[model samples]
Target chain A: MGRAILLDKVNIPGIRAFEVYREHGGYKPAGKALLGMTPAQVQQEVIKSGLRGRGGAGFPTGLKWSFLDRKSDKPRYLVCNADESEPGTFKDRYLMEKLPHLLIEGLILSSYALGVKTCYIYIRGEFKYLVGILETAIHEAKKNNYLGEKILGTDFSLEIYVHPGAGAYICGEETALLESLEGKRGNPRIKPPFPAYKGLYDCPTVVNNVETLATVTSIISMGGDAYSKLGIGKSTGTKLMSACGNINKPGVYEIEMGLPVEDFIYSEEYCGGIKNDRMLKAVIPGGSSVPILPADLILNTAKGQPRLLTYESLAEGEFISGSMLGSGGFIVFDENACIVRNTWNLTRFYRHESCGQCSPCREGTGWMEKILYRIEHGQGRMSDIDLLVRIAKNIEGNTICPLGDAAAWPVASAIRHFRKEFEEHIK
Target chain B: MLKVTIDNILIEVEEGTTILQAARMIGGKVVPPAMCYYTSLKGSGGKCRSCLVKVAKGSAKDPRPIPKLVASCSTPVQDGMVVENTISAEVQEARKGVVEFLLINHPLDCPVCDQAGECDLQDLSYGFGMEETNTREPRREYPVVDIGPLIKLHMNRCIHCYRCVLAAEQLTKKRAHGMLYRGDTIEISTFIRTAIDSDFSGNMIDVCPVGALTDRSFRFKSRVWFLNPMDAHRECSHCSGKVAAWMFGNEIYRITGRKDTFGELEEFICNECRFEKKDISDWVIEGPRKIKRQSVISGNHYEQMKKGSIIHPIEGTTEPQE
Candidate 1:
């Protein structure tokens, strides 16, 4: 209804099959990219597309790919990060399960653009069934001369493999994912040698999200300039949002960027409003890591401008009043949902998932979880409130990875926005 | 060469030098205390966030300050870079928090621990920690298990520094113990309680920052303050055999690796030298080892005191000495 780019053909009866997907123009983009354009031309097109990463970070996709060490004689790698383990986010699973060829075609085009000879799709261990579906689609593509050595009568050749993780949430981080893929324990490596410089066996590697690669098919089919015209400003093209929690029609919806938050929540085209006619209390617009915004703040900014789903609009105010479009995980909460209890639950998840490589995250996450548990169980003290803030502040930017900040944000933001509820629990 | 300014003191170092190395060249309070970094061990520094410092300027070319405090042990210095260690209030507060995190699960049993006088955690807590702990949660505990006849494993006292694991891996032909499990519950243990019986495995006791890994022979020996550590060495085919013999009235209490100012071993000694050769007749003594003035072991020794200072009687009172 609202300009569906990815899921428009998602509901087709046999779209999972390679033949059915090809009948709807699945591998046309790969053919177009390989036969009609040079690798540099394809890169230039992606740079002009202005497509930011659909992953939580919202970094520019083309810019991240541009940072690869092209001058290095070592072979470059393109790692497709299918390890989507973030809570409240399942759009990558839906897209991969329903239309595997679309993702393969995108990978083919992306691999060609980067001159990559080999690539890997690092999916989560929990998504075991999706591995079979993706592998079947890849087999079908190779049988048709679309993948493997010398595709479409061109010099570009690529190989894509499916690597499953051992079910650790920290492996979703790019470096940790690479570490897990390399058959090591999944602890995140330190920075200064970012994945772009020396990653995946100490070679230049670029890790992109599943949806970020799948969107490349559409960008290649329609030129980059045309794709740039779709969304507002820098957040161009369509985004896949997996809406859950209290919404009536809760599922993955591919909405064009710049859609008003109110219409997207209330309209029949998207969420179909809250269930049981319950009053909306708060919403974690991104994944569980992003800040929880109250009902009023989720729909409009502090200056009363109508909030949209674009990166700039949602982040109009900093973290004081704003949240990110992180992986497009829209979790809604009704009045019955206790902020203290939910914060405790999310903190427990972070605490359980921390790799314990560094100090701040390894201890701070568990410390916050304990404090939140005490508060939720009605055994909290008045001084425990500020202690949580202090602990979260110390952990926010002091660890080896972003997991520390991720573990710190929910507790800090919930206490900042819902301090009254915490006080009531203590009382 | 690169020019770097740390706490307003300018110094030039080679191109590949780290910020921690630069600060160590300047020495004194400017050097950040490192619990996990060993100059000889590779890939051992960044896991322990104890050496975090603030980068006020990225470099001369890109002057944007690094937003987050970086672990100085791993970050390479850029030309015209500016760093802040002891001078930054932000760094001091963050370091305090790091110390608290490292101690939240630590069992404070310094009174009975064998590594009491020379433990790095003791020095770190004294320098950067608060007077009272804010955590009421119970400290994590693990049953004391002996890894071999010579080494004792106290999992409760480990700060997860991975130093022993690195020492065993780098020093021995095959390592038996490594970090098992993860995330606050992580412990340094062998697979299925295998005996760590390598030629160089005893060096794990020397590299341990806390009282986690200790010599079984030296367990419950005289307190380190009462014994005089003498620089001693012996010829051996296995290793450099240089060590410090803790002497108590002509009897050897224990033999340990001769440590430098920052608590790192000058040369890793063999298990034969450390555990088997304990008699004072086995080695030639050089002299009394010069302990750092701040160490608890330096307080009671006579040579460490001023040359002309008069010895006061322990039991008798001298009230009239002006």
Candidate 2:
């Protein structure tokens, strides 16, 4: 309802087709970026736009691009992170399935901005059907001269490849995604030598989320200043949220940043309130990895200010009484939902998805899941609560990757906010 | 050179030295227990979270303390960095929690396990684990795998440290075994029932921190504490022939890659020295008296050996000759 940049033309018939998509102003930004703007100018415009990453980390997109080891003689690469495996998040898949050109156009502009010769859209393996749609879109774009060699009569040449992951949640992680792209097991590498310094077969690589790349088209299309004026401070521009769980409508919605959480959940235009008109119990505003908040906290902050969808507003109080706007995976739970069971289910997912590279995540996730299962099934002891908290604390930061913290946050937050629900599950 | 403070003890080490290595270099109680880090092998640490330490002040290159407790094994020492390991109560508790998670599904079959005497997990649990666990749920169990005639794998005992997998990949270059399944159900398995069958396959048993992979040749042969390990070597075409002969009475029960005082293998010996060479006649045995004081398994054995508890009647044998 509020300036839909990403899904504006999604409902159009045959928008996935090249002719229809181009007619709807698909490749204009690619041409403008290629023929008119220098790569440095394009990158500077993005920087001035204040566009943060749509990825869960919310890193500033331009700063990440600037961190590339440009001085190195190694060829630069840009990877589009389309491996959207986060639970309660399906927005990236919708963009790829419906309007693949939007993403392709964005990829071209970004590749040009970074001066990358080769780019890859690393999609989730489970999205096999979507891959066909993307492949066709790429073929059509190449046929139409939007992609491939000497685009728009410019000296710049670019090639895009669609690489599919073999079903791994950890592949959503940039380092692990790079490892998978290199035909290795999806295990995250150690930091300090970040992806910017050394990535993608040990060459400097810029890995952006699918939504982050798609949003670049909007930045170039509307001019960076105009796009920068669309959202709140720091969290600039529109965002695509995958709204799900206990709501009347559960699907992807693109809303300009600074939208009120209350309206997004209860208003008829968005989620249309909880299912069966039941009272809201809690909400996981971000993906399953983020901290879950009770209804009061999700609607308003600890200071009782109305919570907005922006990254700054959602994470106002840190993890104690607040949660993150991670990947915009807005999950609403009605009063009937059990926090213990939900937490257990998420823990199980993390335990299953752990790449088994780090011991804290590999062993701790399994331990937490078992403990959570015991508590969820009326076989828990009171001490198990403290034990669970202790385990989650240990795993929070002591891992080779953020997967450890991802698996830990939900459990810790559930216990922090919903200790009573956990107690009720015990015998 | 980079100067780092571990437990308030100042030391200077070359750049790129990990905090774990620096602490080991200082050589005191400050040596943080590293469950998965094999110093002899490259790219072996970062899996186990046991070696976490707090850096109050970061190095000169990056002055910001990396907001979280970092794995000391993978984190390089920076100039003028301040790291706290056992000195910090928080780090101790976190390590204790890691040890508990490792032991939760470990089956605690230490009494019957062959790697009980020198198991890193056992020593780490004793040093850092809680008195008891709170979970009443059943511990996970796995079917024992006999990958070949040389090794017996108790998969349930594996902590997923990946040391054996690295040994297979780095030392053997065969990569015969890999983790299969996922999450808590993850287990180390081979593609088929193919024998691990590599020149350095026996190193997997030696590198295992738990009793997951035991040498079939030495299975139930004798407790490692009862065997007197003597330094010995043979000239071989395969590799550096340095090895240790574990002798029970006058007969050698098994042979393994000789470890330094720090318990790192002197060299990764081949399967021939590990499995085929069991006789005392395989190499000239060094005198037990001449063996370094650190070569004994524990301080108790060190004192007894110094007091001449078991006198060697022959030059290479511990038992008296008739």
Candidate 3:
């Protein structure tokens, strides 16, 4: 409805095929990138595009590319993180399922820009059906000479492989994904040897999210400055939001960044308001890992601003009164939804998915889950609330990976905004 | 060389040294206690969050402090780095929380456990743990099993340090055990509970920080406090044979790797020296091993009562010549 780039040709029948996708102008970006511009020039255009990672972190993709260890003799890599296991997020699956060639085209363009001879799409094991679709797309692209040796008759050569993760949520984490790709137990590595310097097989690697890499094709298709002008401020270009949970129109929607939260929810083009015309209770604007915002905070800032779906606007007040536009897993909750039970449910997922690497995440997550279960089952004390807070605080920053903080943030923010709900359960 | 400050004590250490190593250079109370990190073991630290320290100033170039407390055991030092350990209230509170997490599922059976007096977890809990636990849930329980004929495994007391796993991996030709499952449910296992009959399997007991892995030959022989640990060695073809023979008078109670001030082995002894040869005639005794004065093993167990000293008051104290 609003400047659909990544999902522009998604609805076209047979777009999953390379020929149909080529008819719809797929892989043109790859041709434009490899046949004309140098890798640095491609990187500069990305830098100008001001595109942030569509992954929850929202790091500048261009800047992430700049940090790769190009000076090293070891071969570089581009690992696409398709393990979209974040609780409320499934937009990556939609993109790969409906528009597989778009992702492959984007990967080709991205791989060329980073000088990666080989690329891997590390999709989650659960997405086995989507893996078939992607492999088909890759096969088609290779047949058409869009991928494999000497792409589009250029001196540049490339190969793309599909690697499925063995169904672990932590494998969505870049390092854990790399470890899983290496045929080992998926445990995250300590930093200081970040993926940029030492990653898969001890080479400099760039692991971008599935949606992040897919969006690169659109940026290359439209000139970088033109793409940058579409979205407001730093949240440039369009975002593919997979809206779900009690929304009338629960599906992925591509809206330009800076769209008002209210319009995105209530408009016929998007979520089409809450289901059953129910009262909006809250919204987890990002994936479940980000803070859950109450209805008032999700719709408007503390300063009474009409909140937009940009990274800065959503995080305007920084956890106190705002949240992040993480992965754009827009989940809408009506008044009947119990925050306490939902918090406990999400906590259970984190506790189960914890890689058991570091102490705080390993032990503290299970501890929090037990307390939450007690509180939810009506066997809690008033002290347990504060105890959960204390546990969450300790685990927030003291781990080898972001999973600790992810596990902590939901419980902490749920308690912060919905203490009365927990109290009611205790009562 | 890199200049780093820990708890306001400045020291110069070699480049690539960790904050914990730098703190060890200026020893005493300044060294943050490490439960999982063994200087000899590769890829062993960072799992246990006991040695977390705040980096107040990242380095001379980037003076901005790190937002989160980093594990001092793994984080390498930078030039003109400033670290805060004991001095930071936030660090103290975080450490108290870490101890709480470590103990929430750990069983309280120290009195019956063989590694009681020398357990690192015991010392850590005494220092940083709270007076009373806040957890209301039941602690995780696991049945005691034997990984080998000579090594006892108490999974409940295991803190999942991965030390023994590393020891088995690095010290032996083939590792028999490894960590299985994940989260709090994670356990060190030989999969189908097979016996680890490797000659170097005994080193796992030396590397264990808790009573999880105890020498089966020494179990319940005597409390470590009742016996004296004497530094001794024997000529063996398998290992260095340097060990501490815990003896009661002339009777050998147990034989173990000679531990240092930090409770790490001076040299990993062989199983033959540790479990097989326990007789007094097997090795030449090198007198009493110097135990830390603060340790319960050293309590009232004076190895030196010098002649004419106050300890021997019958000889009388000599007045200073005026």
Better of 1 and 2 by TM-score: 1
- For model 1, the docking class works out as medium
The iRMS of the candidates, in order, is 0.9, 1.5, 0.8
Off by over 4 Å in 2: B289-296, B304-310, B313-322
Model 3 lDDT per residue over B1-322, tens place: 8999999888999999999999998999989999999999988799888999999999999999999999999999999999999999999988988898899989979999999998999999999998998988999987666687899999999898889999999999997989888887888899698999888889899999999999888888888887777777888999988888887766787888888888787788778888889788898777677778888876754445222222222343222222
Encode model 1's per-residue lDDT on B62-108: one tens digit a residue. 99999999999999999999999999999999999999999998898
Residue-by-residue lDDT tens digits, candidate 1, A9-124:
89889999988988987788888878888988888888888989998999998999889999999998999999888899999999999989989988998898888999999999
Q: Candidate 3: TM-score?
A: 0.97
Per-model TM against the reference: 0.97, 0.96, 0.97
DockQ of each: 0.69, 0.66, 0.74
lDDT of each: 0.89, 0.87, 0.89
Clash list (residue pairs), candidate 3: none
